[model samples]
Target chain A: MSIPRNWRTRQQRYSLKAEVCNTCNKHIFPPRDVCPHCAAEKQSWTNLSGQGEVFSYTTMYNAPAGFEEYAPYTMALVKLAEGPMVTAQLTDVDAQDVKIGMPVEMVTRKLSQEGEEGQILYGYKFRPMLREAA
Target chain B: MRDVVIIGVGQTRVEEHWGKSLRHMAHDAVMAAMKDAGIETADALYVGNMLSGELGGQEHVGALVADFIGLRGIEAMKVEAACASGAAALRVGMFAVASGIHDVVMVCGVEKMTDAVGDEVTSGLATAADQEYEVSQGISFVGLNALLMRRYMHQFDVKHEHFAGFAVNAHKNGANNPNAMFQSPIKAETYLRASMIADPINLMDSSPVCDGAACVILAPADGYRARAKAHILASAVATDSLAIHDRRDPLTLDAVALSSQKAYAQARITPTDVDLFEVHDAFTIMAALSLEAAGFAPRGRGVCMAVDNEIGIEGRLPISTMGGLKSRGHPVGATGVYQIVEVVAQLTGQAGKNQVQGARIGMAQNIGGSGATVITHILGGV
Candidate 1:
């Protein structure tokens, strides 16, 4: 990941900002130029509630380069409340504890460091939402 | 358009060729194919490769391979669709010959993955995914498949053990294939005991990352009657969302269904008429998904066909006839060409031990990036 590339997506990484299709009223995460569903060029910016549920997930035993430190971390496809799914790391829960449909909330966290002196990259990661009193 | 036929096919054993360069492996396959076709020069060349730029630090592989094979001045270019590069290139060659623009065209798929050290190759492979949204989150390719497999097992209410048949079947057939990376056979127990790379996707379930090349020569059926081995009855390609999350139903594999359906329609045949299918078995889950999407089995029951031994050579619809990507090894970009070469071998009665009985029609479906780009080809024996 380059410096400019990481810096460019700060809006989405930091605040869970997404684009809503003006025509179909569907939400698109990571923001797209055009709505995929209705092909509507008109869109609106919206911030997500940062709340979702785990759709699917995996604990990567074999991590790629620059991610070895985070080996055996849990990654998940979280279906947001707004309807679009987001792939992010699951925090505040052990790999064994994560389950399908588990409620989660997104939070900003350090993703990785580029190099010894390179910039530190931070992004959204999901953690289990606190349960209500019984 | 005129009918296109495959006249010759060649391949190198799918293995980690430490001594061979990308061009060396490609040249071996190209020469073998040309020799099989009895031609010294081809009118054009299309090379299918994905990691030449990332792993090999070499691009413009089309002209490089052309010069190495002594076909310097011909029309040469590289075609890529992630892992389906080979079949995509073959599609180009098929169009070239069918359009009567070229008399003979050569399509070669080559990849050298072992040269790079450490996780560099893994990173290179990740480039196939949506870099910004998918790989940016630090998930490897296998991780992505693992997520799918987990979701599938949950959605279908299936166990991890049920999917073992796919890997077992691939190894059973690969044991007889001399050019396969893993020539040894594995059993269900082995699959159960194999180490887990990602949850639900054990080591045995995933295809090995190796290096190799495969090639095929295509010419107009009208001009190459004597040398024609099989007629390319259909060539079709379709795509889906690059990010799996973008799809309405991630498990359906709409691209595979669309491409296979298109190919069947073009060939004027249904799935039942095809004798054997060479599907992309990059992972056990993919094999099951492909079978379902291609109409071989009902949804959530593709694994049942393998469990019932229907995917064996002597069974109803044989798949991975030559070890497939699981045991034969998946060289990524080169796998699509390998599928075509294996189908040609079966159609021509050259598949020694893994031959499908009286195979007259065959189908090969190569998928790129978890079913993002699927290229399906149907061939009929002359």
Candidate 2:
């Protein structure tokens, strides 16, 4: 029917968002409806700085049905500096630069083009932390 | 929870069913199980059919089967856990009885994989992984498992011959199993010499894509027939990190170990007490990993067990007496129930050629997606 609830909710976070548990005082990245640590229904959503460290990653040579053009892309699980772990692509970085414990920051951008049309699916991705360009 | 027992189980031989329709495939399995249990009707029905809605444009399978089997107006539902959908449906039936609700229930798992083309089937199966990330990167199930196998070999210093032994042993067991998809025996050298699909895993090392159906009936202890009285000693499941790269150690299947430990504990039996097992050997490396995860062997020693012939029926702990998914076939949703049916047959002394000697205690392990979701069950012949 409608897009599954989780998929819809995740799609709304075009950028980075975190779930802060009031009871346990833990920030869960990729927010959930409830706090898993404290079992509390009370949670607050906050935009994250998108700064994190790479926990682990892999580069895929073969892609799935729709994402064939994005092959040779890197995917990583990045643990945020605040709290919460999120998985996303590492953009604008050389494959050789991808490694465990690598410092990364989230960046909102278009991930893939929709069908033959130019419709874009905007999503959050990660990249190696770099000095801000003036 | 009330004690639940499996009373009937049946499955059709897996192969290329060119003429069989999906509904007929399911009907044959459910009817066989009903005949085996000597029950004309069940109070409830639970069906697990993966990719049916996507591939066959068929949904509401529970109602469809219930109507066909003349169990109209009964409680019916479908359970899906990707490839482990059948076992998930069994879990639902077990819970229905254990919760002291319905006493007799039918659990069936079916998949018509041959209905689709090869590339389409590959894409559909890949949906089980992280679609946005992993699948989008052109990774199929074979490629993912192959990566896992490659990593295990690198970490353990095991040779490629170890995987070859696993395949050869499964083929030997499958040869004796009439229901197996590949009953013809293959040599280890021949397997090693096959073409590579993914690095380290050859064509023979992987489970074939086939179409089949398996059904089992669950009821309270009092409702079980004499032939169907193999007690459902315990059913336990566990989950690991969803994504492959999220695991702390890719080489170790944490979910398998955890689920098996809980199931064995609940059954009050150790791995040594299990007379035989039907593990999730979707890949040859998976069979080896499952043995290690089940505590039958130490870490990195699964290859040694296979090479020493300790994994066969006459060995210390016979694994996959039904040829496993490797040789028996992987029909996705039906595989878990198929494993349960095989164990029930062995315990009931009904499995002819694939029967283990003096099979008293049997255990089964059905894993999903590289050990992300592992469901384990222990059954005993009382």
Candidate 3:
């Protein structure tokens, strides 16, 4: 995560802003321009409810290089209410507490800390929701 | 299009190879193939590799290997498709000959990962997925497959033990392969009790990261018909979303289905007609998914054939006939060519103790990410 790279993705990370193809009415997350469904260049944007359930999940015993301190952390594919699954670290939940179709909602959280004295990266991560969204 | 025939095949034993440099390992495989083909030179060279730029701290591998192999002036370049780099290079060389671009071409697949420090290879491999979306979440490649495994178990009511047969089969065959990284077979208990890396994906389920190289020399089938080892009946490639979460049904590997379907059409044969399948068993989950996607088994039941002992050399559809990624070692980019060399051995009756009896038709499917870039090649005795 370089400065510019992290800076550019702030919107998607901080707010769960995803692309919605008005043509096919499909959702694209991590916000790319091209509509994979209908190839519509012109698309609308929407802030996702960030409400979803766990599609599949895993716990990384050994994390990647920069994120080593968070070893043995739970990560999951959160199938969103908006209809697109997003990959995110599960927060405020233990690996034992996770399950398929476990109801969750997106929240702003610290993703990772850069090198010593560097910037702290914030992003959207999922946590167990108290109840289902209406 | 001109029909392409493999004139020669060669490979180095898959292992750590801490002693050999990337270029030297590649040179050895290329020279061995040249010797087998009794050729002094070729018009072009194609190198298939991944992580050279990251792990090896080197790029432009195409020119590097050519210059080291003593054919500096020839046309050379590297084809990279993550772990499918080996087969991707083979596909490119086949095109060169089939399209009348070149008469003879040498394709080498190589990867050296043991030289790097902590998580260098691990993070390097994560580049195969969507960097911003997938890798940023801190999931290693094993973690990604583990996600699929968990979902698979949940959806189909499959247990983790059911997948052990895949590793058992690969290791059983790998024990017979002298060039394999792990030369001994393990019992089902070994798989059941293996240390867990990512939850649901035990150590046994994952392919060992090592180093090696494989090469195949391709030429026009017209003049080489008498000396052909195997004819390239089909070469097809297809890709899906880089992010698994982006797919409609993450369980179904659409890329594998499309690529193999195209290959079957080109080869004019069904799955029943094929003798063996050199599947990319990077993970046990991948093996199961590939079998289903390639139509070798019904959806959600790829492990059934393995559990029933039908994946052996004497069974209906033998796979990973020469150790596979699990036992033979997945040198990443080199795995595709290794599968081709093993298939040639089976087709030509050179497989010795590991030979699939009366083998003629064999297919090798090389998958790159989880199931993103898939390349399938069908080879047979001409």
Best by DockQ, which number?
3
- Stretch of 10 with least lDDT, candidate 3 chain B: B302-311
Q: Clashes in model 1: which pairs?
A: none
lDDT of 3 by residue, B231-278 (tens): 999999999999999886999999999999999999999999999999
- The worst-scoring run of ten residues by lDDT in candidate 1 chain B lies at B300-309
For B1-382, candidate 2 gives per-residue lDDT tens digits of 8888888888888888889877788889999999988889988999987788867778888888788777889999878778878888888899899998898899998888898876677788886776654554345777777666765776687777777767777888889888889998888779878876655667888898898988998888864545555998989989886666556566688899999999999999888899998888888888888888889889987778775358777878788787888898989888889999999888988878767889999988887777788888899886
User: Distance (Å) between predicted and true CA of A45, model 3?
Assistant: 1.3
What TM-score do all the candidates reach, one by one? Answer: 0.98, 0.82, 0.99
Q: Where in model 3 is the C-alpha error above 4 Å?
A: none
TM-scores for chain A, candidates in order? 0.95, 0.84, 0.95
Candidates 1 and 2: which is better by DockQ? 1
State in Å the error of residue B31, model 3: 0.8
lDDT of 3 at A4: 98
The DockQ for candidate 1, computed on C-alphas, is 0.83
TM-score of chain B taken alone, candidate 2: 0.97
The DockQ figures for the candidates are 0.83, 0.18, 0.86
Report the poorest 10 consecutive residues by lDDT, candidate 2 chain B: B130-139
What is the C-alpha interface RMSD of model 1?
0.8
Ordering by TM-score: 3, 1, 2
